[model samples]
Target: MKKDLVKIIEDALKTLGIEKPTHIEIEIPQNESFGDMATPVAMILAATLKKPPKKIAEELVNAIKDKSVFEKIDIAGPGFINFTFSKKYIYSEIKKLMKDKSKFLREDIGKGKRVQIEFISANPTGPLHLGHGRGAATGAALSNLLEAAGYKVDREYYINDAGKQVRILGLSVFARYQQLLGRDYPFPEEGYRGGYIEEIARVLIKEEGEKYLKRAFDEVSDFFTDYSYKRMLSSIDSDLKDFGIAFDTWQSEKELYKKGDVEKALDDLKNRGLIYEKDGAAWFKSTAFGDDKDRVIIKQDGEYTYFTSDIAYHRQKVEKKYDEIIDIWGADHHGYITRVKAVIEAIGYPKEKLKILLVQMVTLLRGRKPVQMSKRAGKFITLREVIDEVGTDTTKFIFLTRRPDSHLEFDLEAAKAQSSENPVFYVQYANARINSIFAHAREKGIDTDMLYNADLKLLSVHEELRIIRKLLTYPMIFEGAVNAHEPHRITFYLQELSGMFHPYYNKYRVITEKSEQSRARLALCEAIRIVLQDGLEILGISIPEKM
Candidate 1:
């Protein structure tokens, strides 16, 4: 419908011999009384035409040939053209929605572009924390939105299994194991002291029965690292899966090092003259590609840095032929983006093809009180713990209520509440209410499946029209969220839609004896249900029919 109006405006500009702009801005008025849709194209053209905006608006309005679908077109304050939908058009759209809900679904704007998104690739040193949970939820939701917009999207998790962190994890577990055997071993001061590490030690003792206790630290470190890496990664995978996130690929940093991919990446950079020796270390000239300074790819000790592995992983993604790559990292990794992006440019890949989303920190709350967390103290909450305390749906929904770059305060009390204060509850309740309406209609022998025969014109009430208009905005919301890479926009849209629905449901009944009117309204309710279900599914939240 917006497309249709934009075309009409474009035709008016063309007929008037006025050059059309590259893009037209159409907006819905804040106060619906202004109109169903509004445009500022005439004002946008006023400066170029050297004419008063009001005069240009009037001229543009007069040039539009088909005003039958609009009840009226008027130039409002500041030369904005406001359009009100005629009753006939609204009824037609409602009937179309009833016949086929897909009409409201957005088009395939992506046009088969292949996109690879790697997210929540936390090191398998410990269980996933709240920060990892946010990345997982946001990445999963963004992937779904892109798929809905017709992109061939592949989700991935990059494992940092072959790093110093894993070595520390091995040392931590080894210390715990020695303590279990009553042998004194000083744990590294910076070693991981999480309770989960102790659990791993206990399991290893049970399986091997102190067989590795007498082995030298160097000999047992590899075994402990490999054993703990696999177990911790398995735990991370299980938590993510239970949270409704599944990755298409699990790329291992260990595999990259084993295959010499990191060295290959460095050699490629050296060939391009992007690699330089600085202070006995190999550095990449990242500053030439907008980084603040050159970044060291290898230390003086002949060890590859984490950045070296990351660059290689990104190069691998490019070689895989994905049209676009998206990396979701924690806020602490913000400085890494410029250097990684520089690597892409140094490799002659289009910098625009790679995008990074930095997920900010999450502050958990109980009511209004902040939940304290410390990684070193082993007091931080795990993602699995949050999911266990509150169901997966609640966790996912709350995680996305804020933009990826914004600080999120997820209140436990609000998430568990059953009122409108809780968005998941509110939205799900609306869906459940719609289902109950359909059930009542069914019990009363009202055939909801045959709503096609009902007269949709009976839905002329203001609230009904408002809902119909709101439903028409689904595709717009979908497109906006996908293009902006913000799934929280959909959550906001669903919340507003629920705000509209609860009022309508309370004021009017959908199971009246007026069979045709009831059927039309029931069809409308079902349309709302379909849209709610679609939006919730994109956010990876389930719809409970009886919630």
Candidate 2:
């Protein structure tokens, strides 16, 4: 519908022999009394064409004469063109949604673009904490939104399974294992000091049972390193699955080193004169590409930096020929964006094709007080712990209520609430109420098969029309969320729809004495249910049939 309105304005500009702006901005009037859709195209052109906006609006309004599309094209408040769709057109769309909910979904905005979105690639040193949970939910929601918008999206998790971190994890487990075996072994100074390390040691003891007690330290270190990597990675995978997230590919950083992609990336930069050596270190001249200073890709110790592996990973993504590549990282990595983009340009790939979404921190609160520890993880709250506390639906919905880049204070009390105060419950209740209406209709032996025979013109109440109008905005809301890369917008839309619905239901009785009115209203209710389910499904929230 927005597209059709924009096309009409574009056609009007062409008919008048005026060159239009490269992009047109269309808006929904904040005050619904104004119109269904409004645009300031006339006002925008007024400054460019040196004419009064009202006069330009008049010309554009005169150019559009299709009464079927617009009930009225009025020039309102200085220059804005407000288009109120014909009642027939509005009813037609509602019928379409009821007939086939998929028809209301936006079509192919991405045009089958192959997109790779890599997210939640936490190092396999520990369980996924709340920070990682936010990334998982955000990334999964984004992948769903992109696929709905017609992009071929690959959901990937990059495992940082190589380097000092994994070795330290192994040492931590080994130290704990030695302690468990009554050996006085000093733990590594920089080893991981979490209870999880002790847990890994216990599991290893149960399995190996003193077999490694007298082994060489080198052999033990090697065994523990590989063992810890596999065990911790398995835990991370289990946590993600319990939190309702799955990845299409689990790319390993270890594999990058084994396949020599890291060296190849650095060598490519060197051949392009993008790298220089200083202080026995191989450095990339990132400052030339707008970085604050040069960065070391290879250290004096002859080991590749994390930045080098990241460049190689991204270069591998480039080689895969994706039209767009997206990385969802924690907010602390904001400074890393500049150098990563520079490397993309250094590697001769379009920097514009790469998008990095930084997910902010989350603080869990219970009522007015901050809840510090996870009962299950015994340290910071794990993603799985939160899911177990409040099912997957509430976890995902609350995670998305705020923007991914904004700090979220998740309230435990509020999330589990069954009242209207809880946005998740409120939206789900609306869907459940619609279902109840249909279920009641069936119990009353009302033949819903003849719903199409009802006269839609009977839905003349102002509230009924408002509900239909809000339902029609689903596609627009979906497309806007896809374009902005923010799925939080959908949650807001569902809340608004539910807000409009509850009052409308209370004001009007759907199962009326008049059979025609009852059927039309029920059909309208069905349309609302379909849209509610569609939006919730995209957010990975389930819609229950009963409250």
Candidate whose TM-score is highest: 1
TM-score of each: 0.97, 0.95
Per-model C-alpha RMSD = 1.6, 2.3
> Which lDDT values do the candidates have, in the order given?
0.88, 0.86
Cα miss at 332, model 2 (Å)? 0.1
Q: What local lDDT does model 2 show for residue 456?
A: 85
TM-score of 2: 0.95
Tens-place lDDT digits, model 2, residues 279-355: 99989999988899999988999898888899999889988999999999999899999999998899887788789
Worst 10 residues of 1 by lDDT: 413-422
**Please, what are the lDDT tens digits per residue for candidate 1 over residues 250-324?**
999999989999889889998999888889999899999999989888899989899989899999999899988
Q: Which stretches of candidate 1 lie over 4 Å from their true place?
A: 417-421
Error of 1 at 58 (Å): 1.0
